[model samples]
Target: MDIDVFYGMCGENHKRLETIEHLFRDCEVSARIWAGLDLGIRVENAKSLNMTDWIIDWVRYLLSREGGVKRVIMFIAILWGLWIVRNKIKFEGLAMNSRVISGLLFESINEKVRTLSDQVDGENLKKCLKGGSGEHIEQKKSEIRDGHPLQMIGNQEQCNVIRVEVDAGWERTYAAAFRWVAYDGTGQECMRRQVRTRAESALQAEALGVRDVLLWAASGGFLHLDISSDCLQLINEIAGVDKEDHLIAGILEEMRGLSSYFHCLCFKFIPRHFNGVAHGLARQALKL
Candidate 1:
């Protein structure tokens, strides 16, 4: 039998020969996605590790963690997203962004969280999905907010709840930063974070800021959140009052999925002047 030799090429970069490690971990695009996930998995340290052993070791390590099962699920989701993106680029000749995979990962993880039962692993998965810290908080039933401005929680009612204000700083260059400041019931600052990302527009930047705070607050076990943002359009999009722009539709959907994790969640539109603290923080983060 006569056969022709086949050459394997990297689907993402096109210039390099394809190997499991290069396609999944070492490719420039794949490396950025892994870094974005912030899972603490050091791809650089695994230079000498075979792909099989690397996967197995991470699985075992995640299984030993507090939310091992859920973390494992997320890890699998990342791998799945990476594979799909690679296929799209190879077969469909499509250009893909790292954030697209992140959106897919959130959607997949959210769907998986719902099917989990009431077993210990299921509960752990739920906690992990909700961004709950390893703290014990009795689960309570809550419904998604309908986004009625009238239904908005008043400042008086927020006396015992965390009032988290989120804002974004964006430049025409697409460099952006999201900042959130959390205040205790008494209106004293308790927590704050500044994160960097890229966005195409001001509205999209604002949406990303809200999503960032939601994930952080949930992870910190802040079950009841009153999240305020200065971008009224983004708030309206989240509350279903206005149609979300195509640029941020996926992020809005992900935010809605995260809403279920809280005992109560409220979205409030604050004037830019009132949101000065978060706005200033976000701008300052851009310089960092």
Candidate 2:
């Protein structure tokens, strides 16, 4: 069948060329879907412009992570889901909600994993969805493995430490915002701040947020601090677990330098939901 075809723009956003990279990773809808998955995988950090190379690179990276095989499977499933969503929009004029796509993917993966549980070493997959009853798994929100152990501080010395949560929101236009909320030892709110800035990538935005938060804590006379962030990669890089990412090396170095100002400061990783307050604040700052 021969048909007239002229448009080359993405079906989902109609903003960029309908290349494989844009369809699967760069599209607005695809971005939202990935963010909603709650996986620490950052599509914005993709280093390759070629689709095949991009997939291979991400698969290799995921295989080295904690839930190796399971992560790979989900990565593949997300690509497949994105394609399905693109086709639905392109052929049927139907715009699927990002949450609906996420829910469907989770349900499909759960059922398939269950059906094949006895056929393979599906233990990791099963564990990932343990509390799930054919619904989206809450565990995925915090699945990024902790990079390193927190620096030990005597319990006596931690009595007056303030805890803070920091997060960043980034856009494709390079506009970014950083936010941090601090709480006293008694869990009372002490400081909350948001700053607008620009970043080259999401990782850079996260690193900038951590650095700003550390500076705020030190300058505000909060000598001892327990800093938390939902960006596991940033936390790991700061702890020297994953230092290969050269993109944010400068910010990380500044963060390390700032650490000396605090008598005791530790960076911790928390789930996205746990960092909701700072996350929302950062998103709000992006509008300013």
Candidate 3:
């Protein structure tokens, strides 16, 4: 049934049958390969020197004399071979190859993967990126409810301290496979908004990155997360612990209170050069 379900997704009957046969055949072949090696036989070259013909004959010689499932794969290649022959003879067509079948299967799942990519959370960071917070932050936004215009401007100051970059620079490639990855513990339903950016410093980019993640999380049941950044000066300014940097004091306070649902909130500082991948994302975030 599992094969039937996915097999139908392939669309071509001959392709479906071929892929199913190959999948089962490969699974069996791989499972028994080590045993063949231990027996000191070159299974791969069995096609040459008419070895498989004689081997099947020898296997038949054994089947009539003694037997097992090993006999099935060896002597009964005809079970699958027969169907392949019938489709060719009846429909005057060739069977589909494994590669083409895989392409169709993946193509069918690509859009769902994109939707899933948008819903995932918490940066499972790579070693090369720094400065930027998460690799794939929210990319688009939508209004989930009706609210007042006054609420529309709801204190950007009162919002949580989200460091964001302006563009979607080099970070998207790492995020390209995002459609398939899962968001941690959120059970798969996610709402993501696209981000817009201007060329800015890593700190500013990192700022935007944090903003997008939080903005997306706000829509779902997500409320708590300890955002890690490499900007120590910004965190101190945000917490009001570092007083004299008077520029964003109001901005800091507003973001600090943005979350009414979070159990706790935190912003941590990390090193710049060590934050390469995130930094790349931030740099890329600026381009988007």
Candidate 4:
């Protein structure tokens, strides 16, 4: 079936591909899959018998088949996520390993379980979140920054805020921000940008920030992200309760193009009082 993104590829027959063409793309997915495949190989020490050659041959075979099995795996996982289906594989429970990411991705977790659902209490298990039924997570409003404490998601602080200061300089416009860890989760990068003044408005600035991050991460490969800003007005606008002015339409247009690569991304707001560090960075960028 052709997706909208297929037709949208600007005459680039992105949707329809013969076996050879499709396999070429799956080779890219294999690049990602190989990271996980390595562990499976290492566990068995499949290094004997010119293993690399055999692996390459196997991949060529899968490609010849147009990656039919891999696509089915991805489709099934997406379905599990949509239906919230819980099941098991190899005697492993389904809660910890959802169809989306688990079972396929490698992790720091040790002592593989027969039941699979067995996990460290503090980490992701059945239902993705490591808690009883994930009800606690849903009730808390501290997931992002506000006047109260912010809960850290991943490496992010619960309510960390980003302050982007724009400079309307005589020569050129630029921006920057103060960098700090509101939640600062592991395997994550945290920083801020304070741009100089733009022809666009502040709401446009917020949209640009979102767009820029999405574009960068999809191209650069980020698994998780939590971006918070003190621009409540702009943040709300990006969340779509308010309409954007004409100034930012073009920038937003660019951002919508970046969607497939990210796994989790959330934008948040912190009160201005808590945004002193970002505010300082913006002020500093203007002076430069």
RMSD of each: 15.4, 18.4, 23.6, 17.8
Task: Tell me the lDDT of model 4 at 87.
Answer: 18
Predicted candidate 2 versus true structure: per-residue lDDT over 1-288, tens digit per residue: 111241222333464336666767766666666776645666676633445445655665676678777676777667766655555556766435556556655665555555444454545434332321322221112213454434422232636988889999999999988999999989999989887777899889888788778767767877778888888788777655676478787566456545555556667788889899999999899988
Q: Compose the digit string of candidate 4's lDDT tens values, residues 1-288.
A: 121222111113334432322222222332244345422222123323232223333433342355434432332233233222111221343333233334433221211221222323322222221123443334323333344223222332443323222211112242422223223344333544444434334455455555555544555455455555666655555445457557665544343323323333455676667666655655565566
The 10-residue segment with the lowest total lDDT in model 2: 134-143
Instruction: Please tell me which model should have the higher TM-score, number 2 or number 3.
Output: 2
User: What's model 3's lDDT at 196?
Assistant: 41
Model 1 steric clash pairs: 131-218, 131-219
Clashing pairs in 2: none
lDDT of 1 by residue, 129-230 (tens): 443443323232222443433123223343467889999988999988889999988889999988777789989889888887877787888877888888
Candidate 2: C-alpha lDDT: 0.66
lDDT of predicted model 4: 0.38
Candidate no. 2 TM-score: 0.47
Which candidate ranks first by lDDT, i.e. highest?
1
lDDT of 3 by residue, 35-106 (tens): 342222333433322222334334334333333323423323423333333344335543444544334333
Ten residues in sequence with the least summed lDDT for candidate 3: 145-154
lDDT of each: 0.68, 0.66, 0.36, 0.38
Model 1, C-alpha of 204: deviation from truth (Å): 1.3
Q: Point to the candidate with the largest TM-score.
A: 1
How big is the RMSD of model 4?
Answer: 17.8
Sort the candidates on lDDT, descending order. 1, 2, 4, 3
